[model samples]
Target: MKKLIKLGIALVAIISLNACTEDDGFTFIAKEDPDGLTFANTPSGSYTLTAANADNMAERFVWNAVDFGVQTPVSYELQGAATESFDNITVIPAGNSTNVAVTVSEMMDLAEEAGLDNDPTTAEPNTGIIYFRVRAYVGSNGGNVVDQFSDVISVTVNLPEQSEEEDEDLPKLYVVGNFLSASGYGTDWTATDGVPIAAEAEGNTAYEGFVYMNVDAPQFKILQTNENFDDNYGDAGETDGVYTGILESPGVNAGTPDGTGGYYLVNVDTDALTYELTETSWGVIGNATPTGWDSDTDMTYDSDTQTWSVTLDLTEQEATDNGFKFRANDAWDLNLGDTDADGSLEFAGDNIGVPEDGNYTITLDLSNPRQYKYSISKN
Candidate 1:
């Protein structure tokens, strides 16, 4: 009987020990990492982005859910960078989801931020390769979660050619110093005398305009504003035509044109930190003009109206069924045409035809830009 009683006590003690160790919703066992956390639908080999494709999806990164051997929810993040190691990474929160669709505009923004040039025409390589990876994490609101990363994938990013119309909202630039004077030095550095760089368009940061330079005062500096020297730029060296030029200190060597001083079209790109001074002249070249298609009839600048104007006699032979267009420096490379034969001037649109042959005063008003207007008044 005693032995039986002892056996019964031992069984009760074993049952009590098991009960003490039981857990309702917790354990000390280490959780296994979620499986199948790989990229399911991968990106393409190459992607070409343009203004038209801004709303289109560039890539849809699909991945399997991570199974952390539990019922815990997981969050996935899509990250990208220029470097393969993702040292300079841009993380895009994908929420507690398994897929994320990136738009072309979004990808372009990322590529540019990653040091890829936005210009496709002149940029070396033209196509930038970007690396991407997916990371999955689990926890209560992302607290105390384990991170698992998928294998990296790369995609080639190609940007469309930057249209002149797209660059119509850049900052302004000015021309100061000897370039304005015959002695290679100007007494008045005031805004009135300081040549203003005409903006490419009304709301553009890029600027272009013609300036007369003489050998005596060939040197010049570019300023953001004509009233102050707070923001001005000069040549980094004596080198001319350096596209990637740096802004030198004041009173330093100024930039000169490639050839002897003449009328130059100064083009400045503030965003790219580049400038170009090319000898240029403006003229009308078309069948409808007095000069006809064989030669050009030049337009003179009217400072009062801030436009180019000319008075010419349009004969019947030149005006009848003939159209005209404006050319820069008498070159076809840079010219203006009209579309729908409307007053709205396009870079290379249709021709502006004469309704009737008569003596007229023509004015090309580029003050508002992109909305360039012109009027031909028959006299």
Candidate 2:
């Protein structure tokens, strides 16, 4: 009986050993490594990028590796954007490598996209900052579930100013005329107090603005300065109801637009040496109007106030649907809307907000150039 019991114990021990060796059925759960990544090599100071060193290295971005709980492969990449918020990101693959070397040409492209310009006349600055971050992802996919990102880093880039910038300051002009004195626009309202028609921009030669003239056969002159008439333009061939005219500096006589007199949109070009005037009539159009985007509700022009006024019973649907916009001559060729909803008008901008269903007097004032404004008075 003792020998039989020993044999049975040996058989049980061997069976237990075989069961322990067959533990391959256990599942391994891999949780994303509960850790964050940071820049291991942060570049400091501003870098001046040039075309000469376009092929040279800009900087080397290095980051630490990630262990995704298990031995699962973790892929890394570099992300760059012009904005600090990282909108519109550009991706550069790093594969399994933790470091990425960016060339000077690549950085220049980034700086340019960030609005860095070497031109002195441009509104954009020469130096700007570009943003970057490192992304560590697990497996082959880089989705939100298994992906983690390093803190954003900013690098300042500069473009050297051009030695010779061809563009010079654009010319400016002022409209001086007889209609100004009686209007009480300025203290004197003569050539000295002439309404301005400056260049559209600092480096542009063309000038534009709105002018209110209530004179019969309105006569005027274009002057370079409001202080003096030293540089002035007069009639080369100007006539009433004529939309455009060529002018000669130190001209023979003042410009006589044989107009019945109302508000006119004026445009002057120094390069072309010509002036154009358009008698514009404004209107309102949208889902808010009576025509409901199919047509226009024309507004009447007031010569005294230099405004286009209209009274309409805005639809209830307008308060929920699209609002209205001020367009010229019942056409979308020239339309203005409250882009910022700040009562100021921009071309092809956001639709103006519609008021509650009520009769309101809406005024469109294009008398001010670039500073076009509108008014809404509840009736």
Best by TM-score: 2
C-alpha positional error of residue 185 in candidate 2 after TM-score superposition, expressed in Å: 3.9
Q: Each prediction's TM-score against the native? A: 0.44, 0.49
Each model's RMSD to truth, in Å?
A: 25.0, 21.9
Candidate 1 deviant stretches above 4 angstroms: 1-170, 179-187, 191-193, 198-205, 212-216, 238-253, 301-307, 315-322, 340-344, 365-373
Q: Give the per-residue lDDT of model 2 (tens digit) for 155-258.
A: 66677664323212334577777677454455333677776665656768788877766567566788888778886877675442333378777664454354
Candidate 2, position 323, lDDT: 78
